[model samples]
Target: MTTRAGLITSVTLLLFVALVAASALAQTNDSVAAACDAKVKAPDYSLPEWPEKAEVKVFIVAADFNPEQIAAILTPLRNWSAVAEATGSQVTFVYSGPTAEHQDCLNCLTIMRGKVHDNQKHAAELQATVNQGEQTILYARLVIDRVIPNLTALTNAVAHELGHNFGLRDCFECRAGTTVMGLIRSSDGLTGPTRCDVAQVRRVYDHVRIYSAEVKRRKPQQVAKIVPVDEGEEPVDDDTPIVVKKP
Candidate 1:
């Protein structure tokens, strides 16, 4: 009932539509990749990362948070653990219950509800103390504002703060509702770390692993030496520092 030329034309139109759709999908993927790269702000200095396969104990400094609030606060930690496993990162965070201990303890991440004021003065903030010489995070203190409006905001705040503990900085230019590390909280119910955030985490830990291996290879003799130097002591000959690069 149809001419050969007409059938050929119909097939050609279908192929054209398919090609356009594929091209659009490819462009979208490329855009997402570019955005991910832009959102990751790598420092020029050596990255401070958790030791390989380190289990960072999470301590809630204050016991005032209710069950729901506590659950919201902890959700991000568990989500980050899953992200780490999926991305081949060696770090994991385990909640160790409420703590009366000081915030300076090693391998501990303390979270407490308090007044946090920064330039943006968002719902939460984290201060990570890093041992720069060893390129490792000693401990971190996360302070959350006590007056979050809802559980969704609380979860997002915790997730964003935890990103800092993993050595990520805020991406002010990133679109809101896209990634947890963005300056603006997501509005579309995103409360966990996105693929971009996890990818950066993997990149950081990978850098640490590669650097450690290179150090051992270059200075095999000094790898086992743990001598403590005086504050003002002169540097030793084999104590040459390795400059860490952002991967």
Candidate 2:
């Protein structure tokens, strides 16, 4: 008994409701993806020892970043070092802000200030040159934008960028709350690395074993003590007198 116009209106309203429902469902899926607890696979390789004998060095460009921001960045790095402490691996991170002359040097991490891919949306980035077979990080650059001016944002940016140095890769799946390496979500506090991140870093740096130069070189002593031995080739006692056998 409904008129044609009424039927058309009813159909349009139903379509509108369906579209709204679809949009809502998509948002829900996106949120669930972001919150998915997943960890990135750890690197199977290791970085070579630094020529200068440093385990790790983090240098930030002397920009207008404040003390809080710097401290926030250092927190995760120190946590990362703690994982290597079991092997007596000394991981050192210095703020060498602008004073680091060897930013391009091997095994060094340089934090720079610039636009993130010329995109205003991104706050920071991490780039590196890793070697093959050895998987050594010859050099790394951490680009961040101080213009954001948010301390928490900057700190989180630093953590995310440094995560790359520890072998954290971009999320291949819905690996959000599992670690800082995952896709950042509203649920993320952006404070520090999660257990998954620390475990991965440990796996990477645990290969470093501390050894002394003398032990590594296996060099013989310059001087040798003279000892008298038997003519038959048997070793003589310390008190045994040397028997001079002259032909």
Assess each prediction's global lDDT (C-alpha) against the native.
0.61, 0.49
Off by over 4 Å in 1: 1-47, 101-103, 118-120, 184-186, 213-247
For model 2, where is the 10-residue window of minimal lDDT? Answer: 228-237
Number of clashes recorded per candidate: 0, 0
**lDDT for each residue of candidate 2 in 8-66, tens digit (9 for 90 to 100):** 99999978966765665455344434443533544443323322235666676655446
- Please list the Cα RMSD from the true structure of every candidate, rounded to 1 decimal place: 16.5, 29.2
- For lDDT, the strongest prediction is 1
TM-score of 2: 0.53
TM agreement with the true structure for every prediction:
0.65, 0.53
lDDT of 1 by residue, 126-196 (tens): 55665433556667777666655577777777787676666665665555555676543434355678877
The parts of candidate 2 lying over 4 Å away from their true place are: 1-54, 86-90, 97-102, 118-121, 130-134, 146-149, 172-176, 184-187, 204-247
As a whole number from 0 to 100, the lDDT of residue 168 in candidate 1 is 64
Please report the candidate that would top TM-score against the real structure: 1
Cα displacement (angstroms), candidate 1, residue 154, comes to 1.3
